[model samples]
Target chain A: MKLRIYALAYLLFLYAPIILLPLFAFNDATIIAFPLAGFTTEWFSELTQNKALHEAVKNSLFIALMTAIFSTLLGICAARAGAMANFPGKRGIIGFVMLPLVLPEIIVAVSLLVILRQVLGVNLSNWTIIAAHVLICTPFCIAILNGAFQNLDPSMEEAALDLGESRWSAFRLVTLPLVMPGIISSMLIAFTISLDEFIIAFFLTGTNPTMPVYIWGLLRFPASLPVVMALGTLLVALSIILLTLAEILRRRGIKRAGGTDKGGFL
Target chain B: MGLLSAPFTYAILLLAVPLLAIVLFSFWTQDFMDVNTTFTMDNYREIAEKPIYFSLLQRSLYVSICVTIVTVVLAFPVAYFVSFKVHPSRKSLWLFLITIPFWTSYLIRVFLWKVILGYNGVINSGLINLGIIEEPLTFILYNVNAVIITLAHAFAPFAILPIFVALEKIDRSLLEASQDLGESKLMTFLRVTLPLSMPGLVAAVLIVFIPTIGDYVTPELMGGAGGKLIANMIQVQFLQLNNAPLGAAIAIVAMLSVTAISLLFVFLNRRWLRGRS
Candidate 1:
């Protein structure tokens, strides 16, 4: 019973700053402080008028979309192999690939920056950022899809194979259909991670910065703080909607498969 | 062979090669506008001599450790509540609520921490109005405390998942059996539940600690002048100082330290388990 109160307080501590983002965003004053002056959507209106912000948003969307597709595609291959195979060095390889999940983003960003620019002499662009985002996102996708594949009945795919279907065809026809929901959720979550990511974008973005980088640029000016808050409120809303959608899809997928629902990445 | 083809190539080229490049780069020195390919130890020597590097690394580890402990300790109860108390049918809902804030922009979250901790920020103003305190607290923002608070908050969800999974994996009958054997609830928890959850606790600690140490952004944004960590210095070395080799060396050092500490933690957990039974 006492733990219940502790849980609520823990959540409040976890949520306090986030709760503050919307407050100051709507508060009708430049100074973000106590005593609500009035309610206004002025800052949000300001968000629509900024040309650079619009461009940043466009850049972020493209990068995120590419990252989602590529990472999820890679994730399907990896997670499928993980669930289906018993190869030597399997655990080592999976752990190696998943290292990016825990590797410091700073390290990832800087190392990739060095390798792309210094070693490969590849110019920094949206593609560069996408490459980095994919590296990070693949691990997450694999983690999610791993659960999905594990919950699957491998015998269905086996039956397909025994009926003269090739291995690829068996997976394509049977296993793929079963895991489509996981694929969608994986893509959505990957899209969110890439879109919200900052440090990698900070280092890897070319002339056109991503939205987070643009927000970082805005931090230099004190006047634009409200605009940032408004922008943040929207980003938060968008992510929540995406995540909620993903979770629902994942749950529905589990139900459709007649499996008791386990937890998802949500 | 087919399954390993695409991702293995992608991971190797993208993840493996770049990490190798950093290590190779660290062996050389940087000359103005050019990277000298000649192998040298100057960067490591500089790291050894410079007090700031040590201090920053010390602070990064200290900050990372604090964030890990706080996040894991605080998260355990929430994880436990959801796993042990909540109805299984609603477990996903609770997990969803827990993870929603995590899905929000991490950059924005850290920036907001500045706002909440900044002078005339949320807490200060809220407190001043509530008559809880006369003066605003100056110590929270642009300092180590702020960094810890922000990182801990960001990593809370990460810490919770593993611990919750661990707690769920425990056999309920064991707890019942312990209680049946005349053990109090507290004794059963300490002897049975806590020991069983160590794997999750260790994973949570590493999950929180590794990235927090490498995180320079929070320290950069919320850490003010005095709050820079090792990652900040690594950033400074590569970007501001034009010394990629030095930055590479520091990163390599930081990475080694993390790996060593993580292994030490696993080792300690094993010994503790051995001692217990």
Candidate 2:
């Protein structure tokens, strides 16, 4: 049917680059062209022995982990405050928090770089990248967590409070358990965003480059094509896994709560 | 209260302070020793005086507009199919297919285009072997065309996702009623479906237009001189040229123009939606 073809093409358009990544990655020749020279595992093997590549991977992982934890914790506080508390200027504060989502990322990158390098005179390192990631990732975390927080029955918290529990204890025991899935999803998404980000890493990285920045550097070297493809294949796989996990958690959260809302992903 | 203050204070200090400083730094002039404190209009004036700056800004807008238009045109059918033609069970699968690309590195996608469009790369090599052209074309790899294609590829999902959400919200019975009234499929689409989906269309434009205009990577990698956008100019002023005031001025101008464009579309679309209501 015409519908089937259209759907197939749509899916292809979305995933062709991803499918192509591993295909050429496994190709024997370094030249990333048609007519694969032969089948070989050399590029995948090369990925193991590259010391700098391993170091960069480690650094990127460390930063992403920290960013996910930091941003998700912040998101919990912000989302809970926005949902539960009677705060003045709440709408304005929410808009301010979400501003980074709409702001041109290059502007944010340049702005943060200027602040870090020129104004603060701080040395650029993993921490600089982590700071930048948190600023951008926190908004997204807050957005997702907002959905979870809003969907919760506040009566449960109120009931816990009536049973001789403090506000913090009520949130921890009743509310936290309910929203744990959302929290997990938020962490996964934040981690993925930080790991895949390039412009901030480009500006803020001193000696240690993130994976995307490392791939950008390799584009200048023709022989590095297969290696880059190999790396891209790994990243692509990781991203798909992470995103799938996030979506599964989201669905589980929604199903458990028996509620639906907009703005699951931003 | 003190515990709550930790997150709020951290965000304000780390995030808010840096953002405010960018605005302040926009006014300060750069000295040989360090940035000077004197506020001046030189940076704004410099951007205004350059015809190239205006043309680049115009080109960036044009490219993004073209991409937005293409995305909407292509996405409407797919969004329509996913929301209506497909069964409820298949909707998530379709959405996952659409959004999975976003999970991967953007740089990798852009780099894939380089391989696809490079002189000795796949597309050209196929063309050359088939004798479509005597020589490989440089225009495909590093030009405005390349920039547009790359940006369109990157942003197509953003356009699709919002439009899909909007279409999903429509009442199924409305379409049934239109068919009951003896309207053709195309007519029903124009009269009922399109009008209902305007918000998503506006959102699609915002999601695509705003980011594409400010995108520096696509223009830098795929656009040679032909593709250098205003973001590139701002970047030059900030990093290579070491003129933060001028860069900031250009960035502020770019932001203003984007805001204006987005507002214009939203206002016009609001009127359209209101008329339908």
C-alpha lDDT of all candidate models, in order: 0.88, 0.82
TM-score of chain B of each: 0.97, 0.91
What is the DockQ score of candidate 2, to 2 decimals? 0.53
How would the docking of model 1 be graded?
Answer: medium
For residues A37-156, what per-residue lDDT tens digits would candidate 1 score against the true structure? 889999999999999999999999999999999999999888888877687888888888888988988889889988998899999999999999999999999887876777788788
Q: What is the TM-score of each candidate against the true structure?
A: 0.97, 0.93
lDDT of 1 by residue, B1-277 (tens): 4685678889899988999999999999888989999988898899889898888888998899999999998999899999999899999888888888887878778888887888988889888888999999999998899999999999999999999989989999999999999999999999999999998898889888898877878998989899999998888887788888889999999989888998999999899899989
True lDDT of residue A19, candidate 1: 90
Cα deviation of A113 in candidate 1 (Å)?
1.2
* Poorest stretch of ten by lDDT in candidate 1 chain A: A257-266
Q: How well does each candidate reproduce the native contacts, as fnat?
A: 0.71, 0.52
Q: Give the TM-score of candidate 1.
A: 0.97
Off by over 4 Å in 1: A162-166
Where is model 2 more than 4 Å wrong at Cα? A85-88, A260-264, B1-16, B126-138, B275-277
